[model samples]
Target: MRLTSAFSILCLSAALGTAFAASPVHTSGHAVTLDLISGQGTANGGLNFNGGFKGSKTFTVPLGSVVTVNFQNMGTLAHSFVIRKGGTVPTDADATDAAFPAAYAPMKVEAGLKTGMTQKVTFKANKAGAYYIVCGVPGHAMGGQYIHLVISKTARTASFN
Candidate 1:
């Protein structure tokens, strides 16, 4: 009887452990840093992400994760970070307030940081698709201050039998 009880408890513990492991776990997500630089010369400045200039850069994050962006203003002027998931890409003709699509109107972020300032913004990567991270400082994005953010599908974890 003693041996049987010990075996039962062990089995219960294993079952509980497996159950816990199979459950979806909450995570604090990931972080990436970007620098907002103004024009160095005749070339328009951009947000540097992953060692690439804006409008030509891409950042990847897992879906269902929280993404934190640490933006540093390394320029001589003020700038902001705005994120949009859908709609036409803003152009020089669009105003900063109208740059983002109406569908993503709520997901925008404007840090309004001055030169040599830094700010942090966090958002959930619930959707899997291409997102735009742009500077909403009137002419910044139109001047090539933007990045493409790709939210990839989350990897599935193996479950214990």
Candidate 2:
């Protein structure tokens, strides 16, 4: 009876360990995991990343730090993750094409993932300001597929003279 009990406990421990390992890590060291998903709503068919829109719509990271985005497309259609140099998040429908380039003429980083696919995108947060993360696919960003990313300056200690 004692031997059987010990074996059962060992099996249970292994199962728990596997579950924890498969779970997504929010922030691994300096890298942040951003999970992107599409086809959230039936009416507008929105997009979501890292539990935003219904949760937190803002992502904060340290300036000049390396950020990793784990993008996943859970929708039936393909999607892309594109970071532009701007602070405003567009609200109009199918206005991504005209509004995106007009405001953020130059894009910082961009990545694309097909339907039911995942990708890892790593970029440095060199700038300290608010940036807009949107779907590069046409009509996607305007369909409410965008989030605000705030890059804060590193904390520093001041010395009095």
lDDT of 2 at 161: 9
Cα-lDDT of candidate 1: 0.50
Number of clashes in every candidate structure? Answer: 0, 0
lDDT of each residue in 78-116, candidate 1, tens digit only: 666666653567442222442223312113334356766
Best by lDDT: 2
Candidate 1 stretches greater than 4 Å from native: 1-43, 46-54, 92-111, 154-161
List the lowest-lDDT window of 10 residues for candidate 1.
98-107
The regions of model 2 sitting more than 4 angstroms off are: 1-25, 39-44, 51-56, 90-112, 154-161
lDDT of 2 by residue, 1-161 (tens): 99999979976875585478543324434555444444444434546554344224666666655666666666656666666655456542222442223322113222345667766666676677866666666666666677666677852211000
Clashing pairs in 2: none
TM accuracy, model 1: 0.56
